[model samples]
Target chain A: MTFALLARCGRTGRIGLAIASEDLCTGAVFAHALRSNTGGSVTLGGSPGRNNTLACNLLAQGYAPARVLQELRANDPQCESRQIAVIDRHGRVAAHTGEALTRSALHRIEPGFAVLAGAAVKPSLVEALVQSFTASAALELDERLLKALESAAAECATPPRSVGIVAFGNQDYSDVDLRVDLHGDAIRELRRTYDEYQPFAAYYLERGKHPRQAIPQREFADMLYAGRSGNTR
Target chain B: MTYSIVARCPRTGRFGVGTATFSIACGRRNESVRANVGISKSQAFYDRATDPLVLNLLAQGYTPQYALGVLEAQDPDFQYRQLGIIDRAGTIGVHTGRDIGPWAGHAIGPQCVAFGNGLAGPQVVEGILGGFMAEPDAALEDRLLRAIEGGRDAGGQASNGQPRPERSAWLCVVDRGEHPLLDLRVDLHDRAVSQLRRVFEACDRGHLRVDTR
Candidate 1:
């Protein structure tokens, strides 16, 4: 299973995740993003529930980086089987990858950002994604995240037949937002979906997609969660 | 350059020619041949005047060997060029021009055949033939890949010295038991090919994998 996701929450935060696995329907297991006052975690190849709880708890306690990871390690039995990256509302970041990962897997943590990628990935992909963020001029954080995923996909000599990416951010209650998921030739399809929906830059964003009324969270969620084939666009 | 092609009409069991050389647009030339029943002389190959006409005569039920015999009776200098075909009933025929490139040849079989030119030697054709013969169950796409790979390994196009990284390549297979288009060209380099493939696959998935209702 391979998946790519991008989400933006008001101006408070941005998050991205890409995970590939030979297992069918792996997307339903890995790739979890949750953001609240405390912080958020972009967890891949790990327990979705435990990871989500730890992230929510850390944010609740105002914990950041190493402190949150240390607490997570203390509680989890198979810490090495998980790959987790977290960034809070304050731009603090931390990541961890268990030593039990296959030889083909690894993680990288840097200032204010981290990349946890593996499963038949070239070593250069991680570094390229991280470096491109600083050098590329993306209008939004989500854009940068998508570009990073594209770079990773293109770096492979023989790219895996499947690839995916995910990005999410916490938005203030008043800010406009969107969430997108896509698969297949990850970069091409992702860009296509972005252009077709024009979600981030939609004129309706400021108006909240309503001419004379404010769209409630439940209504927007209903619209966002409706799953239709990309062809429906 | 020399090349060959064979395909069966989906509605009728009629097999036809679908390959050409001289430039990259063999797809176009193959179309013209499809209207008629057999191989045609290269527009520029002057000496071989009525090769296509001969093949059409054979399509009327003459033996491939007899068909080539008739063409030989007309043009004694036929071996100087290259053309080949296998009709619907396992009938086979081939022609090689003396003026054609060195070491060009072909071998026909019940279901397929191998042909090539500008190769290291006749063994290149042999290698392609062997590859097709070895993989009986492979889809035509895979068989084409094996044949092309075999030709490449056997010194494809004699002048291809240093590996001139191919800008593009194509693979196609037409068999009677399935759709006329089994697997269309997958030009990994062309944005159009991948983009079109994505759209088609998405449509296919939408129709076959998901609940339309």
Candidate 2:
């Protein structure tokens, strides 16, 4: 019903996750990120919201990704029906796929990233996700995660209805949090949204941190337009 | 309390709305948009239900004027509300009630309508239309974004002798799907329009990398 990729940027230590699902608001329910410099978690299948919160709390408490998964499996009564993925601050990853899931359920873990899928998602889709993510190592964490999700969605039998991507930078808040809660073609919409949001990420960071000196948005747009016109000449 | 633009893209048949205000979460209570149907917005002494109701009526094949009429007939506080509607065919309807206060007005253009209350002046609506029409070949989302920026540049909302900061802003566009093609918002910020601009620009640049540790 859902597929996701979680990864950490080797250079910046930023952790991010991208997910798509047939269900509505998958990002709101399944994805959780700890504060800046910490790791993140995603919980799918049964009791996702509670499991995700517990995982994040554990990650915040300095527990390793493997230890977080162990804690979840030991405490959750319905762990057999759940799929969980955790990535720690050091880019180490761990994942769990329950036996109660369908035969297609699977996951793959690499050095700095992990890919997981719930029931109805084929193993081939997971493979595509891993390959896509691994091949895009030179890109930013957000783009790498999104490209992996896009590749998996392209291989999926049914198109997803919702998609979300989140990346935590050095700030206390997420650097990028884009979600298409519901759409007939959620992955495409998410891509479009992500593309449109890319240029201003640093600008927003600047404005958030230094409100007085940063120029206005209209002024920024004018500057860009002027610069483009100048270059053409 | 807010200035907004509701429009239908002639080239793509997409519907879009952009709004900015002195309040927080202005988009949550002010916008109702359905793909391949129409777009609606309610502001001033805003009612959250008016937008969806107008969109519902448009989906049922009613005219934008008829939808406005329905709202006027049903709501006892209609006089305090400002509303705008654009149907799938690009027909637009707008109302600025008597009780909406100073600088309340609206402007109707080729395929869109700009409306607001508690604004700086009529220039705000005029600037919105001007900005939208300036870029005929741009994407609907981009055009709507510029339209709101134009409004902000023209003056935006004001009270007493001072201009009020745009505390919140939102841009939404819908294509042929049940959900929106793009829904971006900046809430509870002093310079929400600029913040929204940054978000919109980031969507295009695709270069948001994490800072080095």
Candidate 3:
């Protein structure tokens, strides 16, 4: 019913997650990121909403990804129905797919990222996500996450109802947070939205921090629409 | 160069504007909303000040048509401007300046006015109206988002046998307070309207927040 990837960018120390689900508003319930850049976490299946926050809190307290997973399994009575993934600030990755998940449920833990899918997701989809993320090391963290998600979504048997991607940079807030809460073609829509947002990612970060110094949004649009360099300032 | 929709939700008395353009920041200079008063969008050789002025006029109990008349009488460059104005009473006024360029037009719908200049065709504005009217029972922000997406899908800005992409887009909705209920902008993007939709969805689901300040 849900698939997710949690990753930390080795180059920039940014942590992010991309997720899709047959359920509605999956990102709102499953995706969690620590503002302090401690790491990112995603919990799918039963009791995800609560465990997601708990994982983030433990990560913020300097718990390793494995230790965080252990705590989650120990505390939750229905851990067998849940799938969890955590990526710490050090780029360490850990994931769990409970025995009660669908037979196709699978997970892959790579160098700096973890991929987890449960109930209706195939092992091939997990492989595709990891492969795409690993091959796109040159791209930005958000781009890699999106690309990986796109790849995995393409392999899905049925289109998801909702999809979300989030990335936290040096700032306290998420640098990139895009989602399609309920769409027939959520992954495609998410990809289109991400492409449209990529150019403004840095501009938004600048505006968030130094709004007075940054060019006004309107002026910036005017410059870009005119085919002039918007970065001239 | 731009397409815009300015609307007042009759049920909630909320005002909103959805706009996109080949130019950047279409909402910043083009859109204005005054909570209980009305909403205005001034584009096509736009004067950023005009939107607030129109809203101020609406706040003072002037009709949207009268406000347009005031702008026509006062602004020397009025011939180069396009505008869509809607009052709290759901009264609508729109102008597509003759000098704004080819395919410029506007469509007045129930509680909404869609207008654009340098568009692919008249269908762009019509598409906006259709999209807004398509979902009357939907949330105001969702309707506005769909309206702009409608415009983009109907062929947005004009091109030379090539597809013209919207580089910037914005959607804003204001209710009772001095602050807006929703304000999202894509300062620059190839698929500006689509990006705006993404942001709107995130904000709608509480996954993202737009700094109103």
Candidate 4:
């Protein structure tokens, strides 16, 4: 019912997550959190409970992504329906999906990146997600992570019901968090919403720094997507 | 960063708010309910000050509309904020600032108001409102959850629409008690909406139930 990617930008040190599901409110139930100068984790699939949060805490404590995932899998009673991915501050990544959950449950790993998807998803879609992420080196971390979701969701036989992406940097605050909760095209909506919010992302940071001031809001010309338009070929 | 709805159940006199956001633990800051008084939410560049002020105004016996107006008048950043209020009497008020994100808007329904910013289009407001209205007889928490689910369905641009998960979701509902009768949250999870439902189902129904080994 779902797939998610948890990764950190080696260049910017920002943590990013992109997720999509036919299920409702995947963002709320799934795992997410990153400590600044520490690490992050994402829990998805069948049994996403407190263990997901435990994974994140372990990552924050300086556990290697693989070791944290290992400890979680061994401790959890129901590993068959769960998917988890962890990334350390150093950008090392690890992922696990319960094999019993789906015939097609799979993952793709690359340096500084990991893609985890459930059994219902085709391997091709999972590959598309990672390939898209790996190919988008020139784009910002948010754009890259989002395009990967767009690519993966595009391959579904029926367009996914929902999709979302959240990215946070050196601070615990989000640089961008866009969710197309109930859209015909969640990724497409995310693109539009992200485009709109991108210009003002810096303003929120400033607002935090100066809580008393009525910060000025300005409009900037939309940032153009270069080679990657997020359209399915 | 946030969008939410706070409403009262007519038959039961219970209060609840459904909220979801891109930020972590927005529930702790965005929601306030005085048992049977009222509820209000501030999002799209949320502030720590708004919910508390709305709660204080409600405590002073301010109507939802008047309370929202006063809060808006006092805040210089009101233009960038989206707020919705519903008192225990079911009086409803909502404000969407000019400088709030594009597609920023709200739909005021009878006994409730749904609002948000950073949406794919104005349809998101319509979606939340319609979702809330669809299940008129369900529990307030379920109704709010479904309503926001409608927002997810309302998300995405034109064609090739994809449903997006609510990044973080929370609900607080009260029965005849002064404290939150059912307080549940899914914080910044990949499947926050689902987790929210799971926890609520376990916690609701006149008793407390948590899965413990």
TM-score of chain A of 3: 0.87
Q: List model 1 lDDT by residue over A32-115, tens digit each.
A: 244434555655564344465567567668786678877777788887777767666665677777788777666676655666
- Which candidate do you rate higher for TM-score, 1 or 4? 4
The per-prediction CA RMSD against the true structure, in angstroms, equals 22.9, 15.3, 11.4, 10.3
> What local distance difference test score does each model get?
0.46, 0.76, 0.75, 0.67
**Alpha-carbon runs more than 4 Å astray in model 2:** A219-233, B1-213
The ten-residue window of minimal lDDT in model 4 chain A covers A216-225
lDDT of 4 by residue, A1-233 (tens): 67888788888888787888775445543223555567777777543545645766787777898899899888887876777778888889888877666567777778888888775788889889878998897888889988888787667766765677777666444556666545566667667666645544555556643544633222221132233466211
Worst 10 residues of 1 chain B by lDDT: B204-213
Report DockQ per prediction, comma-separated: 0.01, 0.03, 0.04, 0.08
Docking class of 1: incorrect
Q: List the residue pairs that clash in candidate 3.
A: A221-B24, A221-B25, A222-B24
Candidate numbers sorted by lDDT from highest down: 2, 3, 4, 1
Q: TM-score (0 to 1) for chain A, all models? A: 0.69, 0.88, 0.87, 0.84
Error at A10, model 2, angstroms: 2.0
Which candidate number has the best DockQ? 4
Native RMSD of candidate 1 (Å): 22.9
Better of 1 and 2 by DockQ: 2
Q: What's the CA error at residue B37 for candidate 1, in Å?
A: 71
CAPRI quality level assigned to candidate 4 from its DockQ score = incorrect
Instruction: Give lDDT for model 1.
Output: 0.46
* lDDT measured at residue A219 in model 1 versus the true structure, 0 to 100: 38
